[model samples]
Target: MKLQGVHHVAYRCRDAKETVEFYQKHLDMDFQLAIAENEVPSTGEPDPYMHIFLDAGNGNVLAFFELPSQPQMGRDTNTPEWVQHIAFKLGSMEELLAAKERLVDAGIEVLGPTNHTIFKSIYFFDPNGHRIELAANTDEPGMLQELKRVGPEMLEEWSRTKKAPKTAAWIHGEGEFPGYQG
Candidate 1:
């Protein structure tokens, strides 16, 4: 079952209007469309929702649903705040920096342009308390291919030890092993 690409990814939002406005103003995503339903189509239960979609560039669509009848929306308490987030890719380092500044100027606290050697990224939260990341790639020649080659080994090592594997440490400026350097 080969797939072309992601159609859309959906998340629960506190307010549909606020979410649409935030994405439109801050991230420059187009507010594509909205949907309202009084009953669940699949479940046949009466659960009203306001669904909205935003274009997240490169044919990717980000979506949200505001369910007013349900309890307040929240994230998983057990998971670390940074563990679950929606990451968006920016065109270049310049665009990433500009986005960071724009978020800060809008009174949102942002965290890094943290350099990971292969890429740099900044993080911030939206009005709904959803963490978001904007990243720009800066990979060196053969970097991605090398990482891909080591992916299986890294996953195996991780599964066995539940520890970070050293195979891709160079991407974080960590000490490198031979045959894995620029």
Candidate 2:
């Protein structure tokens, strides 16, 4: 079967109302709809929940579920906090910097306009303690193509050695790879 695109991405939230308001105010996401059910539709279990959907621009949707019956929400203790985050893309670096300024003005502690070679991003936490990243593309022509070319080789090397391969070290401004013209 061929997949078209993502329908939506769902996560757990502490309070549905607070989540809705936060997304609306900070991120300018429109509250598209909400679903409330007293029982699981797939299963027969009686677990009431409030599911909220927000329009995340360009036909993308971000959703959250508030399950009051469950215990307090907690993150995975094993994974590093920076590893798991929801990233949204902006059109330009100016927009990214503006967003950081707006978030800082609102008294939110935001980290970075950090450069990732291909893009720049800023990080902040929502009221629910979910890390959010707003990034803007800054890739040069052929950069992605070069990375794609070396991806399989890098993966194979990583699988064997369990360490980062130097095939794409140029991404971090290291010495260029052989046969790289970009």
Candidate 3:
């Protein structure tokens, strides 16, 4: 079965109202709709929850659930903060920088304009302690094509040694990538 696209992605929240407000104020996401029920429709369990939906632009939806009856929310302690995050694409470098400024103005501590070869990004935390990243693309025309060209070789090397292959190291401009390391 071929999949079309994501209808929505849902995560747990501490408070539905606060989650909605945070996304609205910070990310400019419109509150689309909210679903409240005393029982889960899919599981048939008697657990009350408030499910909220936000517009993530271009027909994409981000959702959250606030389960008041459950224990307080906590993240996986084993996972590093950067490993699990929600990343959003901003229109341009200017827009990404502006967002970082605005977030700092709102008393949020943000990190980076970190360059990832093909994009530049900033990182911050939302009210729920979820790491959020906003990135702007900066790749040259054939950048993606170049990466795709090396995909097979990279995967083959990785499969054999379980180590990061150097095929795409040009992005990092190190080791044999034809660039100064400093």
Best by the lDDT measure: 2
Q: What is the C-alpha RMSD, rounded to one decimal, of candidate 1? A: 1.7
Per-model clash counts, in order, read 0, 0, 0
Off by over 4 Å in 2: 176-182
> Can you write out model 2's per-residue Cα lDDT over 1-182, one digit (the tens) per residue?
99988999999999999999999999999999999999989997999999999999999999999999999999999999999899999999999999999999999999998988889999999999899999999987777888888898999999999998988887777865344344
TM-score of each: 0.95, 0.96, 0.92
Q: Please identify model 3 stretches exceeding 4 Å from their true place.
A: 175-182
- Lowest lDDT block of 10, candidate 2: 173-182
Lowest lDDT sum, 10 consecutive residues, model 3, at 173-182
Against the true structure, candidate 2 reaches a TM-score of 0.96
lDDT of 1 by residue, 1-182 (tens): 99999999999999999999999999999999998999988998999999999999999999999999999988899999999999999999999999988899999899999887778999999888899999999987778888888998999999999999987887767865335433
Clashing pairs in 3: none
Q: Report residue 123 deviation for candidate 3 (angstroms).
A: 0.6
The TM-score between candidate 1 and the true structure equals 0.95
Ranking by lDDT: 2, 1, 3
Q: Can you list the residue pairs that collide in candidate 1? A: none
Task: Report how far off residue 45 is in candidate 2 (Å).
Answer: 0.8
Q: Give Cα distance to truth, residue 181, candidate 2, Å.
A: 5.4
